[model samples]
Target chain A: MAEIAWREALNQALAEEMERDANVFLMGEEVARYDGAYKVSQGLLAKFGSARVVDTPISELGFAGLGVGAALVGLRPVIEMMTWNFAVLAMDQIVHNAAKVRQMSGGQLRCPIVFRGPNGAGGRLAAQHSQSLEANYAHFPGLKVVAPSTPADAKGLLKASIRDDNPIVFLEAELLYGVKGEVPPGELLLPLGQASLKREGSDCTLITWSRMYYHAEEAARQLEAEGIHVDLLDLRTLKPLDEAAILTSVRKTNRAVIVEEGWSFCGVGAQLVDLIQSQAFDDLDAPVQRVTGLDVNRSYAAVLEHAAEVNPARIVAAVKQVLYREEG
Target chain B: MAPAYPKDLVLRFFRSMYLIRRFEERAAQAYGQGKINGFCHLYIGQEAVAVGVNEAVQPRDYLITAYRDHGYALARGADVGMVMAELFGRGTGYSKGKGGSMHIYDIEHNVLGGYGIVGGQIPLAAGTAFAARYRNDDRITVCYFGDAAANQGSFHETLNMAAKWSLPVIFLCENNRYGMGTAMTRVSAVAKVARRAVAYDMRAESVDGHDVLKVYETVKDCAAWCRSGKGPVLLEADTYRYRGHSMSDAATYRSKEEVEAERKSDPIPRLRAWAVSAQLATEAEFDALEAEVKATVDEAVKFADASPEPPVEELWTDHLVEPGERDVPPRERVRGVKVDWPRYPSGQELRVKWDLEPRIPVQDGEPHLKKPA
Candidate 1:
């Protein structure tokens, strides 16, 4: 197995899926001639030709709705939004139309569609470009939300999302796209709703996903030096939450800390904290702590940006705080 | 090919219209008697739109529509009793009582479910056309909606996509002048819905929906254009609904005089006049046809009334997918995901466990189940 960047892994998955399926097609603003805004769809236009790799107008709502419509009729369409922030423009179609089509049609129609692109805090992209809407999307029931951290997970989850019978929101972290990992060759499909144990420990449980999984691992290593063992859980699929895995981890450690890139209030991290409290209340030895991005948008300056969001240092502090409370 | 409709064909169209009118009237009565529940949109004054349009398309072509769908289903050859049972939420219904009056689907006939939300069926119809093209089928889609839906975002979006891709679909807008309690004049600045088709650069026209011959000929021409791969077309059937929007409608949106005026120009009587003038049928023959239609509707009602209500156990039958069934399996998933031989979970009992960590990988060294050559 050779190591490849997360973005390249995504590209390979698209190429493989397209080669295998005649009905699978791609559509987005820069997906065709320009390769892709993020270059994840690079080399696809040349390989699949124009019919499959379609370049759409800047009409997000129109094309997204059209993708849903096409999915209903039998075409498996992978729609790439330039960024997750832009998906808000088409939220009506994604939420009301695509997500609910199967249930509302009384099971008459099923949308085998995927909406994927860059998401979460990506460097200093600022307010409009850098935002995680996973919590907002996960609020809806019929939708499946997937956020992949590693290159292998990116390729496998994207392939699985495309193949799924239901509509899926595949949220790719912009910061993690260039990160590299070993991906099994040929074809692979990682199942949705299964969390991965990024690192094992005993003293406390650190639950996170996407780019934050890396931060959680870093914090866990630092705490291991301080004699505080931390178990890191990467929630590959946010919607399904992998409740069994999370509760099991919480039950084992009696202490929990949730981390997310979005603002803490009503964010996906907050939802996790609630789930832990409800499921493993008796097992918890200390109040659950959380490390999340600030409520305001990220500032352009490096200093302000660093203070605006959670990082490895903040995660370590939160874990330490939970452990100290457990001792007290 | 442009020859005048034969006597038999003309008589058949007349009979279909009469059947729809009588059936809808009976349905309204049933609703009044508390037999039918939920929303019931009648097609009392819109008979020609269904008859004329159905005559244009082939049996294999796809058909989709909005909530005003009783006439369209009847025109598409859905069993009258089955449709009535659907309205009554019975087991023998087309959707097994899952879909009511506003939503009826027949996959075998390619009649997609009627949508409740205004203008929702527009994009779905385009998708159906896309599928037809992908399969290399000559079948075209005929999507019917109202003038109100023409103002919806889906209408514009679907039209643009259909035009850009040259999908084989015909957007049939039955401009019945009202959407529920609101009049067209109140909602849209430009009352003519057909003119909006120019935005999509699709071929479009306004036809007198009251004239069955006109609607039939126009839809036939449009259907031909779509079948020939010339892309989508728009046919605005300018019709009117004699009854209120639904069974509960008071119809205060328009005056009684307007209703009377439209009734005077009713499609059935106009067609009957031509049939008689052309010596296609006598007054006695027309009366006999009307009597036959009433008897057919009466028989349908009896059949529906006698039909047993859907059993409670069957309510959940079509609600969810079974264990082995996936709605639409992506091509790659079916072909790419490899499997090994005979490792299927054995026996009646099955147990599953949740792991905090990723589960152990199954070995791939075993001989894979090979497909028979």
Candidate 2:
């Protein structure tokens, strides 16, 4: 295992996949000569050359639709959106074309493409740039959604996503690009829809994914030091959601607290709440508590943004409430 | 310069035009009887463009277009029985009843799809050529869309990219004057769709859409220009749709006189007259050809009517193609990926064989259109 930054892990995954399959190619704004908007694609242009690593103009919908076209004809295209926020411009292609092509063509056409980039709050970038839009994509069928919080998971999931014959939305956090993690080398493909057990405990289950996993992990540590142990499950795949793992954890713990760095209403947490209540109704010792970003537009100020985002303090408090340790 | 079209080829064009006209007429009748519903954009007056452009492209080349697509699919060699089934939303349809008339797809013929969204197909057209170019394949793409789609950002962006990369794709604009109920002049200041290619520095042309021979000649030249790797070419076919936008509208936006004025250049008769003048066919043969096409369309309807509905379990299938395990036991398992599996999810072969070749005789034939005379 090699300790590397999250960007390198993703870069390695892209390089390896491109080398493995001739059909695999990468395209997006600043992905070639500029080395990607986040440097996640650094050295790809030099290694693969311009034909594979394409630099597209600032037409999100145009290029995104083009990727879908390429995918339709049996090309595995990895489209890099500068950010999930900018992806809104290309949502027509994503929401309508990518998600509906398979079903629309009655399974004649398959969209085996990946649209990846940083998602959610990118350091006080405000409302437009910081919106967490995974739920919107997750709502669409014929799409697989993955967000890996660690470098190793990122490499594995990204490789699996690229290989899977389905359109996938891979979300990354700008803040976590520089975060270091130990990544295993070579063919590290983790099958999609499998949730990883981040931490093991019996008291309560902290269910979260993407960047929220870190905050939840920190909260779990603090609670552990105080003599309370909980199961922290990071659900990497959101669409073909790991219902088995979720049910197993909730059935074991009999209590749940979902942490997410996105708006509460209609967010990923909202769906989890419904799933837990419906499927694990008899298993719960207490009602599921959710700590999510406040239902409001993301603010630019640090303090307001801090209040809106899910942090260790809020997560700890939610866990305590679910465990009946803090004020309910 | 295109060589003289063979007698069989000219007869095939007439058969294609007649088949489309008859098919649309039957489809309209079906829609009225409530056998088929939803957006049924017929290609009645625009028959020449579909047949001529399709004839010009090689079988290995690709084609994509917006809605109003049954004609293009049929001309590109999609099974008429399946095409009719698709209109009826039956299990045997091209998309197995999943894609209605507006979304007919014949992947085997390289007719990518008929996109419902107006300008959505523009980028897809360019990308199909992009994929071919990536493999150094000489195959080009023919993208069909209405005049209004040209105003879309994707259209402009695609033109820029196709030109910049010198991609082999022909953007065929069927400028029927209006977009739905609204006139194209009201939406964009520059209504001539082909002229807009100047801004992108791409090859462009405006052609007589009503004349089948002219459209065929122009597409031949344009396709050659694209295949030679000059770049993408935008060809605007000056034509008009004889019917309403869909089955729903009564076509109240236009006048009966306006429709009549356009019918004088009716491609069916115009081409027949030329074919007769060229001694390609005599008047008597056209009558028998019309009967044969009508029977063909009738058989299609019966085939569609008898086809079963897709199994309910089909809803859950083909959503994703998950490769099993790290290694295959003996050989690779069929993962259902189109590229991996040579067969379609419905167990249909990827390369579909066209069963219903036009039976129109090569000898001189008659030219009685039976409508708009």
Candidate 3:
């Protein structure tokens, strides 16, 4: 096992996967010669050559559609969006073409590709750059969504995602890149739809994913000191939901708190709460509480931005509210 | 110089146009009977454009068109029954009934796909041509779109790219004069859509789309030029649609007399007259070919009626990669710009697991493996 930053783990996974598969090529702005906008593609161009490590023009729609067409003709292309924000320029390709091609073809063709980049709010990137689009992608069924919280999970999950037969939207937080953890060595393929238990507890179940999972874990650690045994579950894949794991945890703890870095309205957290209620309604000790960002766009002010999104304090408070609430 | 395409080819082109006309008429009937659903864009009067351009290319050449694409598909050699079944949402239909009339794609036949978005396939078609040239293939690609698509950004981008790279592609604009409800006059300030190609430094030509021979001669020359690596060309075939934009359309924008006036110069009768007046074919031969085409149409309708709907299990099928069939290379870097698989530390076999399939072996110092699963 090697301890490295989350960003390095992602880069390692990408490098390892590229080394493992010949068809696995990377393309994006500054992804090749410049070593990627985030350094995730560092040393890739030096190793892969230009044909595989393609540095494309700033036309996202053109390149995205080009990648989709290439994938249709038998090439596993790993497209790196500069960020989830700029991906909107290529939304037509992803939503109308890439995501729908397989289903639209009635399974005659499969887009075995991955679209990855930084997602959700981090630091003071301001309104346009900072936004969580997991729900936006998860709204579509044909796509598989993966948002990893830890370095090990990022690398393992990325390897699994890159190799998956379906089109995967891999959402990584920009702030989580430098965060480190121990990653198991060698070729590892983590299965999708499996929630990892970050921490075990008996009083309440805290369900979250991506950057929010860290907040949930931190809150769980803080709650443990206060004698509130909070269960922290990291939902790596959002679409598949890992309902069995979520329900099982909810059944045990009987109290649930869902956290997300996205807006509350129709957010991934809301979907989890719905799942908990429907799957384990009678098992709940109180109403399921949710910790999510404000529905408005993320502001640039440091204090306002910090308060706008889900954090450990909010998650802990939500857990406390859920654990102490009375049912109607 | 134009290749001496025999009388039989012209007759076949006529029959194809006739088949498209009849098939669409039958589709209108089916829509009335509630058999076909969704947006049904008919290619009534614009049949000649598809037949003429499709005739200029070989089966190995790539073909793509916009939403108004049934005639293009039939002209490019898509099976009639499959086209019909696609409309019926049957399992055997093109796209497995996933895409109705607009999105027919048969990669084996080299018909990339019929795009619903206008001008969306332009860049894709250029990319296909680029791939062919990169692979040193001599084949050319034909990208068909409406006159309205000329205003799209992809049109400018594709034309510029094709000219700069000298990719073998033919951009055929079937100017039926209307883009949905808006006439070309209302949308385009400059009426000569073909002239737009000159902006990319590529050759541009406009032909009488009402005359199949004119369309054929023009496209064949341009296609030849592209095949010789001279670069892409644009052909604007000024045609007209006899029917509304789609089945549900009232066609309130255009008058019936205008449609009838355009039909007076229809390519079918004009070609038949030449085939007879020039003694290229006998009246009997023309009759026989038309009858044969009618029989094929009858068989297609019956085949579509008899074909089963897509199997329920197939709903989630074909849309993604089928497990166990891995031919697309792994997306990774090998050495520099070229992406190859990892090499085992020399003299040792580097076995790597890609997905659910068996472990693949990579040579020492080699970036790729023996094969995908």
Candidate 4:
């Protein structure tokens, strides 16, 4: 196993995948020469050459649709949106074209493409740049949505996403780029639609994903110290959701708390809550609680931004409330 | 410089345009009769553009267009019966009735699609060219769109990328005067759609769309330029649509006089007149061709009318290639991560292919439509 930053893990996956298949290429703004805006594509251009590691002008819709078109004709293109916030500009291509092509073409054609980049709040980037769009993308049926919380998960899930024959929206946490973790050495690919049991306990189940997984884990540790054992589940993939894992955990703990970086209204956490209620309702000892980003758009002010986000404290509070340790 | 076309080739161009005109006329009539439904955009007056471009390129070359694409499909040699069956939403259709009039696709002819959204296929055209260049193939992709689509942001963006990459793509803009009900003058900042290509440093040309020969020559040159790895080219075919944008359109925006003036340059009649006057074919020969085209369209309508609707079980199929059936396997498998296998909803069985025999009982309440002995 090698210890690397989350960004390096993603870079390694891209490099390895490009090396594995000649048809695989990377394209986006700053992916070439600039080494990516967040440097996730660092050293790719020099290694793969300009033809494979393309630097595109800042036209998201054009490039994204181009990537879909390339995928249609047997090229595996990994498109890096400078950030998922900017992906909103290319939503039509992502939503209408990439997601619908395989089915629309009746299996005659498939878009084997990946749209990846940092998602969720990056400190005080404010409203436009700090929104969490996983739920919006997950709402589309044909798309596979993966949010990797760790360096290991990032490398594994990204490789799987690139190899998968469907369009994927791989959401990476901008804040977690510098965070270091041990990734399993070569060829470690994680499947989509699976949840990981980060920490095992029995009192309450804390479900989260991406950057929020860390908060849920921290909250689980804090709850353990307080004599309230919690089961932490990191839902790696949102769209073909790990229903079995979620239901098993909820059935065991008999209580649940979902934490997410996106807003509470119609967020991924809301979906989790619905799943637990519908599938594990008879096993629940208490109402499923949620700790999510405030419903309003992200604010530029540091204090307001901090307050708007869900942290370990919020997760812990929600867990305690679900476990009946605190009043609603 | 235009190449001197052979007499037979000129006659063939008239036939191709006439076929599209008649096919679309029948499609519009079917829409009125409720035999076909949903967002049917006719290629009534712009038949010359599709036929000319299709005639300019090889069968291996790719073609993509906007929602106004029945003419392109027919000109590219899609089976007339199958195309009409698709409009009828039948199991025998090209897309198995899943894609309606705006989403016609035929992999056999290399017709990428009839994309529903405005300017959606522009980037896709560039991508197909990128694929051709990547594979070191000589195939060129021709993308057809309306005049108003030239004003879309993707059009400029795709043109720039195609030029920068030197992709083998021809951006054909059929400037039909109106996008839906809005006039080109009202929607586009520039009067000439081809002039927008200047911003990308790509070659652009405008041709008289009513003259099939001019369109054919321009596209032939453009295709050659693209295949030589020079770069993408933009060709604007100045045309006009005789019908409204779609079946539901009232065409309240234009005057009767303007419509009449544009109709005087109707491409099918113009081509037929030129074919006869230029001694490319005799007037009697043109008359025989028209009769042949009418018969072909009538047969297509008959086939569509007799075709059955797609089965109810098809709703759950073709979403994605199932696991273990994908062209490539997942990068690696992780323990504890559940691989969700697609399951058919209750009462629906996974059918590899549709049994197209007549399902409803006939006179004797037994299977009626059987394969010939």
Q: Write the per-residue lDDT of candidate 3 for residues A129-148, one digit (tens) a residue.
A: 99998999898867889998
TM-score of 3: 0.87
Better of 2 and 4 by lDDT: 2
Weakest 10 consecutive residues of candidate 4 chain A by summed lDDT: A101-110
What tens digits encode model 4's per-residue C-alpha lDDT throughout A292-320?
99999889999999989898888888878
Q: Pick the candidate with the highest TM-score.
A: 2
Give the per-residue lDDT of model 2 (tens digit) for B1-373. 1457788888888999999999999999989988798889999999999999988889888898898999898887677878888889887787778788999877766778888888999898877887777766678999999998988888988887777777788899999998999989998989888888878777787788888777898899889877866678888999998898888888898999999999998989988888888888988888888899999999989988888877788678656665641211101111123322222121121121211112222223522111110
Top candidate on lDDT is: 2
- Give the distance in Å from residue A263's predicted Cα in candidate 4 to where it truly belongs: 0.6
lDDT of 4 by residue, B137-239 (tens): 7889999999888888899889988877788898998988888888889866786887777777677778998888888888998898788767788888899
True contacts kept of each: 0.21, 0.47, 0.26, 0.44
**Runs in model 3 lying further than 4 Å from the true structure:** A325-328, B1-3, B126-140, B153-168, B198-205, B221-232, B311-322, B325-373
Q: Each candidate: what lDDT?
A: 0.80, 0.84, 0.77, 0.83
Q: How accurate locally is residue B82 in candidate 4, as Cα lDDT from 0 to 100? A: 78
Best by DockQ: 2
Where does candidate 1 stray beyond 4 Å? A104-106, A123-126, A263-266, A295-308, A326-328, B1-3, B90-92, B282-323, B326-373
DockQ winner between 1 and 3, please give it. Answer: 3
DockQ result, candidate 1: 0.14
Instruction: Please identify which of the two predictions, 1 or 2, would achieve the higher TM-score against the true structure.
Output: 2
In model 1, the Cα lDDT at residue A60 comes to: 76
- Please tell me how candidate 1 rates in CAPRI terms: incorrect
What would you estimate as the lDDT of candidate 2?
0.84
Regions more than 4 Å wrong, model 2: B1-3, B324-373
